[model samples]
Target: MPKKERKRLQVVISDEQDALLTRTAYELSSPERLISKSEVVRLAIEKIARELGEGEHLEEYRAILETEEVGEEEA
Candidate 1:
């Protein structure tokens, strides 16, 4: 827990996903690279937020038409 105020969150996952997360956390852990199941869930949440633009974490994908126009002008 950092200085920031934290809220407890509860989530439900399938048995398979739970097992996978446990395995991943164990494999990723080390003296220098310690990871936890909670970290995995937080990472997943951040990825989903970026992909869904729940915030401006990532810009909308560039349009193919815009890319083609830029390439034509450069050429």
Candidate 2:
């Protein structure tokens, strides 16, 4: 089987968010398997997408994202 191309997503997150990701990844890591920040993000995205099923609350999600962006800018 051929390897599939994966898209890259780059975004600037607040220091608090970075810390949380680092901590979560660390806690989820084990001797047999290690979790990374990227993995944590992927897992989070999967969970959110699953919970939002069918995109019924898409607008609410967009509004929250917009509010977070504004809040970051004002900080």
Top lDDT: which candidate number? 2
In terms of lDDT, model 1 sits at 0.75
TM-score for predicted model 1 compared with the true structure: 0.56
What C-alpha lDDT do the candidate models reach, one value each?
A: 0.75, 0.92
lDDT for 17 (candidate 1): 74
- Where is model 2 more than 4 Å wrong at Cα? 54-67
Q: Give lDDT tens digits, candidate 2, residues 33-68.
A: 999999999998997898689666788889999999
Among these predicted structures, which one has the highest TM-score?
A: 2
| Candidate 2 clashing pairs, residues 3+ apart or interchain | none
Q: For model 1, how does the per-residue alpha-carbon lDDT over 1-75 read when each residue is reduced to its tens digit?
A: 679887999866557879999998988789899899999888877786777676543434346447656866785
Give TM per candidate.
Answer: 0.56, 0.75
Local error of candidate 1 at 2, Å? Answer: 7.8
The alpha-carbon deviation from the true structure for residue 55 of candidate 1, after best TM-score superposition, in angstroms, is: 12
Candidate 1: give the clashing pairs: none
Worst 10 residues of 1 by lDDT: 56-65
Show where candidate 1 strays beyond 4 Å. 54-75
